[model samples]
Target: MPDTALPPTIPTAPVTPAILESLRAIVGDKGLIADDQGKQPFVTDWRGSIVGNAAVVVRPANVEEVSKVVKLCHDNGIAIVPQAGNTGLMGGATPWPSHTGIVLSVGRMNKVLNVDPVGYSMTVEAGCVLQTLQETAASHDRFFPLFLGAQGSCMIGGNLSTNAGGVQVLRYGNARNLVMGLEVVLPNGDIWNGLRALKKDNTGYDLKHLFMGAEGTLGIITKAVLKLWPAAKDVATAWLAIRDPQAAIEILSEAHGASEDNVGSCELMSRTCTDMVLRNIPGTQDPLKADTEWFLLLEWTSARPKAEGAEGMAEKMEQFLADQMEAGRVIDAVIAQSEAQARNMWVIRESVAPASRAEGPGLSYDISVSISKVPEFIERGLKAALDILPSIRPYPLGHIGDGNIHFSFMGPKGMDRETLKQYSPAITRAVNDLVTSLDGSISAEHGIGIDKLDELSHYRSRIELDTMRTIKRALDPKNIMNPGKVLRI
Candidate 1:
């Protein structure tokens, strides 16, 4: 094949107010927005990695409204960018460069559609905030276990769209595993009512899975039936300082394997991570209050006799701590004795991001490998980044207990924007390459929104990328759904 000249350039799409008026009439003033000020929030991604201005933003109150809006957009040859809380990390909820497009905001559709304690599940509108769903489940004495940092504001719809994975993923699995059914509004404005809370449905095709992590390119998730668990009678949380990274992995393996998978959660934190949290985050005082190299946040939930006999469980936890201490693997430990205290411990762990940001700007990567191989990967990643770009401060910390870590590097303080941009981005890619070489995912939790689109080509196979594009084309033939996101179209 010889080099050939390409065809003439295509023209940009035109915008008209007549089309805007038609959209506004469908959604009403309260539901429709056209001004740049009103649209700016929905234009850029959470990280400000990608920015796009839409022709309008629409908020539909229900499935009927969403279907109508999507159908209208599709018919008018308008691109639709679906969004929820706009708290998504992967830029999954952010719109991209507009060839005359609109954003579909699901915020107005928030509602607890259904709660079935007997069924151990809750069917909720996609726009429902995670914290609101948690409260709804608490009212029934049941639990929805998709615990994460953004639970307070992140909408379930966005969570489902990205198939988000958080700390509790070790037990409840990712959002895809938690979702039993979905109610999606397709590109053609038809509704997919897979909202049944059935545990087992051997139907021909599990249509819901297609949109689970499609990031709204396939369709907009309007509602979802999520799997819930019985509320545990008691929970024990502990913060410990560990000897080494490898030993920390062994501890998690031993505890999770022996506890009948009862270990609720485990997280690893480095000294730099905690120091920044305590220094920056308001009301974030240290849990240890003393100098510690590394920390582990461990949690265990039990249903066994707490009122009758829980001495054995408490003793087992104490014995586990004692054994670690004796082996010099664990230097310090503090176990929560009450629910309030347990929540406080979590508050500290969740406050890491904001506190770290207050310290300085940094380039972060959320990547994962097998637990057994995480140490090697981290070591190599740190070495690789430093080799290419020394004088960079590494602030690596995350769910090492689960093989997922937000390995990041903070640029030299007080450096100008140009210098950091020139070096840090190169460093981020260097770390991502290291993640790929170990057969690990470049994106462990966050999807390949605009932020990670570059790495998708580097990590994903040609066949894999092609299959994804085929599915996207099949679901959204016009390529109007979330245009220029995930993959360049």
Candidate 2:
């Protein structure tokens, strides 16, 4: 949405019948999908905003097959677009509109190679779904703390490539911190096996970090070694009505102090976002009897269990909320009394994206500032966004505890898609300018795929951008891996 003018197209090596047959032989007849019907899902993104055309989609079943496929593509000088789960927001995983490349999907490589409970690590194939990994950790009485709404379908490779951050980032850190090692197939088709489960490794260069958040521009992540922690035995979830963003921040501080940093997730939602969820998503109701302009969904978890007259963490959390309410920081609050009720609270948080989309077309910003500057950023950012298009409805929601906010703006009622697209650049600039002024990032958790290319170029320094291009060129000279993604070089 930066401008109507398109970037210069990158030429791709032609995909002939001989190349297709060779690819098919490497993966099986079922692995190579050439028909339009079979390739549609891989080419299109989850949000449906980006649709790409591919000569074919190759699904490799193992690391060897992945290496071979990459090698073949590299030898033929054909571009390769690595896709997994296809749950990205930046169109990083999807091919370009004029792409004449083949999509290398790792979906068939789904497998859990090893799980060491004693070492507190799990080595899994990149194609493994996030939800399945979480469940597998739970089976071993541990927890993989990457909890996103798209966990059910988002693959570990995609999560790693994007370096995804979720609600629990305040406590567990992002995907970059959670990953211990990686097995990547480089752009030139050489395999780098660095899948070590060590806690400390002071090597010459921590090469895995290069590919972890590179958005597949350097290499294809085939497998990973992830860190795990002991599962929480007791979790306390609550919904609190707050006066404003400042109050939400104050309550978060108080919760952290009271729970000794046991607060796992502290999310903020605007009144409009909550309303959209209740109206759009089924089986969702307002948990608070009284409505406020802002809401906070907070939770605390501990490995210690409450039994035999011992005070549980949940009880302490309730007491903390009670004190906060008495002090007037929290207007009203409801603590989940049962597991079902706790899940109900999470439903509202997870339903935000779908509900907002259902309401109308909107420009979303996954931007973040310092924790103390959140309120100021939101207050000024909203006013600036509305200044551009007064009728646009601002729906800001996100993990405020970690300073990331999804400040989105819903289009005015009856606004056509074309009109909305036309206004996108200005709207994005308005919000991004405010974020930059406040020392915040325009692209927080979401990587700069095709979505934020222009914004990134505008805001980032020339030296930093040049260094990134240099690294990209060094790793992928042909610019064959995920072309036109992350960087324009």
Candidate 3:
């Protein structure tokens, strides 16, 4: 396990024999994982970097069971680490190494409660897999626009907790925006059921927002009412070899009108990032074999069906690409002729994280700036890192339209993981400093988990940090809900 800084003071009280019996009585043996081997995966972060420990791994069958288990822990002052699909890159779902409390796994509460096709909304349990919800929405002739690499296993609760930003965020907004209401289990085990599917609710404090992106620090998200959109009947997916980051943004800027405001996603990919994925992830093919430094995976979707011989999404995209090529922004572009072709393009984009893991030790920063500053950030960011480690291989990609970049790098070739760690501190400092100077966020979509604990404290101002701590204390005075996460308090 990689060395990580833990909270200065967290509840380290062990689950004694009596408390264990009480827990078993509440959840039954089927829900409790008492053995260390059974609890290992729950405590370990997805990247396998931070390994924590829990006295027991508890899987509640439903909200009542969850409330009972939490109340038991709360009454005794035992720490509770609420976890969902456990697919977060940040260590938010993982318990701290010193934790002796319970790892509350909500995977068993997977359920789609209601689907309102006319209302364009769905009520679901937090433990429902994101892909499952998307499929459910599709079956109802609707669309859930949270598309990410880990949708297959990541849960809705964790997604909301992280306020996840996926490929389609440019069009649909983040997880919190999609959420109309939430049912959270508070730190003290009190249930807050704000599961109304209303588009307009100005009832005082809008309490649901607090739990959405709190990273399970304020409370545990138990259920949610998610907004949906009409299923796309006409779609266009294309791969364009763009001139550069500037050109990529300009193309997207013009595309908003050219596609008639139907642009669903605009993802920027560096040549190095694409090459890494092609090398590491098998069965992936390059979409456009053009000689260019950058690429854009652009998709446009419309709810209206394509009429015969009419100007549909494909026709419109074709014209846009032609205009872009003439304008010197697009060098070469190909609109997918079939579903299989589009799937292949998306596979290459989504497989980047896994491909990097397969490659070896590396550093990744999920930072963001204004849309226009993306090119400048990339240019200067690359220079800053290369100055520190000239051999470090750069693999940069992002949801360019949204200004969120996953600035990443592979360690110097042939360097061991231990040796790579030595350069991490200097490189991290340089990159973060540059981001701060540019008025950009040091951490973007990925919340400040155990990995960025100190970084958050370092970057955030005294007032901002104090405001966050005040809220944290107000919600979770005992500091038992996912302790040592998001904030030092």
Candidate 4:
């Protein structure tokens, strides 16, 4: 949880009756959501923890409407919160309590403009759902590697804005890496069209990257040209009971050579997290019932189709697991023999967030350190957090291959929300301090939305913060583009 308090420095100019009429003219009544009841879902975050207020919810049907609407807000000095699917864990899309402007939602612009299988790329609107894009890629015999738990509801715009990373990051990369170009709506209502599909352009500074991870503080991403790849024909998914985090790392380290450079994902899960999912999320079964605290979900993929007589991913994975067991790193493991079995294994991993929500009040940190330092950081971090609240239960898991951990904890057995919050400050400081000492990041996959606003200022250097503020000021002079986000300017 983060401090939901808004700073007094942000623009709070209310959208008067005159401006409302102008907005309606630009997007029409169908695009405008003014009533409080219809605006609740847009104002609140996905967690339902951070409820905010907005003058209206504006859903633009196209980039032209988006441009005109932003121009109106700019003329009136009204703050705007550009939203996509509103599925971000961080409160980036949600407006503040003092927000008196509008939420510019691009959900109405969902469209796949083009798909070029030979070029290995696709042009899409920002509002396109992640799973929809993945399926679109599959239809053309290509693959979109960005896969996340929120893919069903999360939009491509938010994913790229936050530079989201998921299971496939180990093989492909982050959301930013997937994008080749972008079309943005500037704060002053001018459109900066950089939506090119070229593989390389040495013309000048690559401006597309400036907004991809800016979390909408810079501008709104309306369209993107995303890079695609050959669809996987041979893939393997496995569940393993590992000795510990260190063992998990060792297994992954050797897996690169053993899998012939086809490691897709390597996720580490604690028994507490797995059991929590099983208890809350239905139809999710335990893949392997081993007497261990830590488990690893390993996957391997290849573009080449498997021949009838040739050994496939399963055979190779079997031999590798056998070698790991002989080395005493792997306690026990199970390879998914069918697609249904693979899906079951993945359900256990992806259902963690919702399951945690159902369990109760908790804290989760998306932090990352060097691949080699993950074990040490986890060890010290657990001790530091436990020292403050000995009764708190820890649920630690991560993309171990990328050194990013969702270090989390549920409140003490019967402790209430307020009670848990009392110790949050101390516990948060202890965990974050340890991460800093190890030269790790406090916010990894999750961006510096309102949740990490203060944390970013506290952890980042003065020079770095100053440089970021300079960029924010240059791009959004009126401070109306997601004000009080990413930077204080």
Candidate 3 lDDT tens digits, 172-192: 998889999999899888898
Give the per-residue lDDT of model 2 (tens digit) for 1-489.
235325535548978999998888999898999999999999998788888889999999998888998888888878888999999888889888788989999998889999999999999999999999999999999999999989999999999999999989999999999999999999888999999998899988999999988999999999999999999998889999988899889888888889987999999989888888999999987888676889999999998776878778878988998888888878998999988888888999998878877887778899999989999999998888788789888889989999999998788899977788888878787888889998999988989887877778889999999999999989888888998887788
Which pairs, if any, clash in model 4? none
**Every model's TM-score:** 0.94, 0.98, 0.99, 0.99
TM-score of model 1 vs. true structure: 0.94
Candidate 1 residue-wise lDDT, 315-421, digit = tens: 56678888888878788888877777777778878877666556666677889998898889878998988887777777777777668888877777677546777
Give the lowest summed-lDDT range of ten residues in model 2.
1-10
Look at candidate 3 and tell me the lDDT of residue 325: 98
Give the alpha carbon lDDT tens digit for every residue of 239-341 in model 4. Answer: 9999999999999999999999999999999999999999999999889999999999999999999999999988999999999999999999999989999
Q: What is the lDDT of residue 218 in candidate 1?
A: 89
Q: For model 4, what is the error of residue 140's alpha carbon versus the real structure, in angstroms, after optimal superposition? A: 0.7
Give the least accurate 10-residue stretch of model 4, judged by summed lDDT. Answer: 1-10
Q: List the residue pairs that clash in candidate 3.
A: none
Query: In model 3, what is the error at residue 63, expressed in angstroms?
Result: 0.8
- Span of ten consecutive residues with least summed lDDT in model 3: 1-10
Clashing pairs in 1: none
Per-candidate count of clashing residue pairs (backbone under 3 Å): 0, 0, 0, 0
The Cα local distance difference test for each model comes to 0.79, 0.89, 0.92, 0.92
Residue 152, candidate 1: Cα error in Å is 1.1
TM-score between model 4 and native: 0.99
